[model samples]
Target: MRRPHGVLRTADVEHGHDLLPPTPPTTVGVIEAVATGSPRRVVDQRANAARVADLFADPAQRQRIPRIYQKTRIDTRHLAIDPLEPEFLEFSRKPATIRERMNLFFEHAVPLAVDVARRAVENLADPAEEIGQLIFVTSTGFIAPGVDVAVVKQLALSPTVNRMIVNFMGCAAAMNGIRTAVDYVRAHPDKKSMVLCIEVSSVNAVFDDDVNDVITHSLFGDGCGAVVIGANQVHQPLAAGSVVIRDSFSHLFDDAEDGIVLGVKDTAITCELATSLPDYIYQGVDPVVSQVLARNGLDKAAVDLWAIHPGGPRIIEESARSLGIPPEAAAPSWDVLAEHGNMLSVSLIFVLERMIRDTRSAAPISTGVAFSFAPGVTLEGIVFDVIRS
Candidate 1:
């Protein structure tokens, strides 16, 4: 069966009243710079691929699991906490509770987010000044004031700086955060806005025998990605080769919400990576891409870069095939996934940082498209016009 490319089937939209709603384009802001940081602890799956499989001790259950972790294409990932640390080794006697896990999130997320944010703003003329707004995005853990407060306090940002948190929005949350930052910059053109996507997927790991839990465990690592967006004409101009927000769009999968699940359990968060996830990405990519491009008055040929989220290998593969994006266009995303696993809410921003920082991308890269999927069975797309320095 051949899947339709570059067009949304009418059938999918009929079931949902709000499949795609185009938002009026926001004022353009330059993506001054991009940066991403990890927790300094690295794990090479290649070395431990077999040993980690031992996490699943039931032989009958183990036989059904693929030792390759589905050939995740992931080579190495960094974690805030080494899963095999002596303390965690006695898991049966004392598995980590949600409270203990959140404690780790607060400890690790702040410095990681602050470092990436400082790196982004360091590109400015004065360096790290003039940032008046902070938008923090993460899905793995929760704190009352949110990590945004921590980012500001550590950076010594102006106490009056506006703060907003995009919580539990999953992988694509960064793109949504970027959109909101664009709105903030547009509304307050004199100010600079910083967006941080910090995901501590390492701490979210559950020590369980469930096959789904095992699969999810193999695909997560801890990391933070940040970008600074400012008015093009501001005192500290965006660095050259910065991506400008051309437009943004949001869409849903009609009835595919069940395909990706992240739910809160009594003592921990549980996730179910349903088999149809690839299908959900496949079905949603065309419409989301088509509509976003169309609304921006862009054609398929305009995009020289594709910043699609690397949710998984299959998600990336099916997306490129469906959207007619060249294999090379998705390589950064593949590399990020292979190197970082999926950092939950922080994953897509890492993809964007790769696109922005690639020296090969050079300058005057006119147009680009970024796509990411979330548990809404939601898809958000952002179109960018890269201005060379």
Candidate 2:
């Protein structure tokens, strides 16, 4: 007699029983596609160093410019405004006010966002109507209705699209945006969501003699990146080269509140980065990652790709060493830093895009983890499996 449905026979179990076939890993959602864009102007490190040197009248601050910038390991960056332009020069000579900077942000942020958003949604089954939610993340600037409203208008996104703007979260904001998107798509598996990260760091330039100001000026660049996320159902199969997001982890370190501070000064936004920030990350990363892997029933050996944020040279280096990730696994982070400087929250998406694209030609990255740091000395990560086919 045949075994009953949903039942297994004792003799079959005692013998070699192939009761059921293996099932695919369940996922919150898949990263369907990614698109990135930058402003027209390109600023190489040498030119940027000269520009920084020009802003400082003090001998001490001016002397530290080269070494500080060189240590950042950035080669070229894109900026919204040309440093030599009259408006930029005027602002540098006499720093732009908060109002002026916000105006610049409003101008550049929307267009860049629209461009990348359009590219991101082009391959969707219904580019305009399919997106059920829009999550926008930015740290450099903000507006009343913000970039999300403009994106809906410009990209012709669904008028009723649910919108959330993640502002002032600093470098690790993208993970928050992705987390939000994942939650939405998982709940509404039939609809898709988008995470847009735009940082026009140039608009927040601080032309001051302070060493922290110089360090901030040297490391950041302008960029916009977007990722479309959706469920892996038959009606909306995972995109080619897409990665199925398995799980995410977020942690906030105690007594590290001041590790990174973004102050809204009268002149413009100012950033204070603690010298010990890397040490905090080094000590904190292992546990956060181990927890992420453990929850997913995995370990370091199971992770084949790592997409750690390049906060600067040291942040990425320390993060990799702490996680026991090989140098080559961290190369994409360093490459993005060198090519685009640190685009704040937008940078990690670039690293993810690079890794996903690289899989096309070379060996596919099967399992991967992406993580980043933020102001609260916060650590965020996502575990995923590459769908190379």
- For each candidate, what is the lDDT? 0.77, 0.84
Query: Candidate 1: misplaced stretches above 4 Å?
Result: 1-27, 60-66, 89-96, 125-129, 233-239, 361-363
lDDT at 312, model 2: 88
Task: Give the alpha carbon lDDT tens digit for every residue of 78-144 in model 1.
Answer: 9998765547645422544777777778888888888888787875664335887888888888877
Cand. 1 Cα-lDDT: 0.77
TM-score of 2: 0.89
User: Relative to the unseen true structure, what is the C-alpha lDDT of residue 305 in candidate 1, on a scale of 0 to 100?
Assistant: 80
Q: CA shift at 277, candidate 1, in angstroms?
A: 1.6
Candidate 1: worst 10 consecutive residues by lDDT?
87-96
TM-score of 1: 0.87
Q: Candidate 2's residue-wise lDDT over 158-238, tens digit each?
A: 788998989888888999999899889877888899999999988877654666767787888999999999877633455
Clashing pairs in 2: none
